[model samples]
Target: MSADARERGRIVVGVDGSESSKDALRWAVRQAELTDSTVDAVTAWEYPPLYGSIGWIDAPQELAGDIKGAASRALNHAVKEAVPPDQTARVHCGLAYGTPAAVLLDQARGADLLVVGSHGHGGFAGALLGSVGQHCTQHAPCPVVVVRG
Candidate 1:
């Protein structure tokens, strides 16, 4: 891990290429500006196993690579849309290969705050706090801020 990986006082935000996540990203960036903390926007992705794989026809690595690329692009787009041009330098993006809650918790290891949208693009879209947000709020190592859509 690099020095940046171990940096403290960072504000970690979970984004999933959703409108609510964009709102959370903007809120996190604003909070970071006020607290003089760096914004670390993170997106997580996983390629589930194929339901019925034919013999020697599965390309898990390629599929996983594509998913990772999409996750990276999504994270970059979210940060670009949420962060102002002047403050972009202070914001960093990360793509994790795991569940959103796990990724956010990992990012929150040495962070000051963990921010997430009230309801992301999860199956329970009508809930106040989606599974990822609820999980992070209850399990994050740091304080969690849930931004409503």
Candidate 2:
């Protein structure tokens, strides 16, 4: 682990390629720069079992491809593009599997701050805080910031 990682944890932010999430990533970079804290940009996934395989089998090739593709695109944007130039080195994107809320809540355990986007990629306009955001706010181990964008 690097010296920065040994500091006061990091600012964990959830990203799903949504406009709101992208905006949240941008804000998180600024926060990370100001606080001298790294940003953990996370995107959780859940892949179905492969054909002719047991439920306990490893993830299928297609699913793995999807996971890698999504993670790559998201990191490129959320960490490289969404994050401001001055804070690039402080931003790190991580991909995981499971429910968004559960993933974020778990990640928050080691986080100094938890940030989430209020609106989601596929959510309706009526929802101020989308289901995932609401869940995180209710169960997060650390203070949560629900950014609206």
Candidate 3:
């Protein structure tokens, strides 16, 4: 990587297969184009332990795999749609099992910018800023950009 590439040109974006997240991805891609930066679109997922609590019959391993796979697919699809064909090589996808904010923060280490949607499919869907965006703005190692949808 060139010295500038090694510097503040790596942008990490949080995506959740939601429209808001899609907007954030677009913003990140546009910014990357302007600065010759790269984009890392990340999505996070976790198997809820309460599924069995409600007497639902499902194998733990199978459920975990299904959830993980869906998350990965969502990340891939979002990246594919948001990034232009010419800039596809500059964008990457990351899927992990954890809270959204935590995963995005972990990925933001040494990154030039952390981007997230203003709201997501969370408890406070109508709020100005969802938990992930709020947490990232407060705790990210680098500057955070919350793209409002």
* Cα lDDT for residue 76, candidate 1: 86
Q: How many clashes does each candidate structure show, in the order listed?
A: 0, 0, 0
Task: Give the number of the best model, judged by lDDT.
Answer: 3
> Deviation in angstroms for 96 in model 2?
0.5
Tens digits of lDDT, candidate 1, 1-149:
66755553589889898999999999988887887778888899987655554543434686887888888898888888888999898788888888888888998997899999988776674566788888888999998999986
| lDDT to native, each model | 0.84, 0.81, 0.87
TM-score of each: 0.87, 0.83, 0.88
- For model 2, residues 70-103, the per-residue Cα lDDT tens digits are 7668667766658767677787778877878898
Residues 1-149 of candidate 3: C-alpha lDDT, one tens digit per residue: 66765764889999998989999999999999899889999999986755556685544767888899989898888887777899898888888778898899999998999999998877574577887888899999999999997
Ranking by lDDT: 3, 1, 2
State how far residue 148 of model 2 sits from its true place (Å): 1.0
Which residue pairs overlap in candidate 1's backbone? none
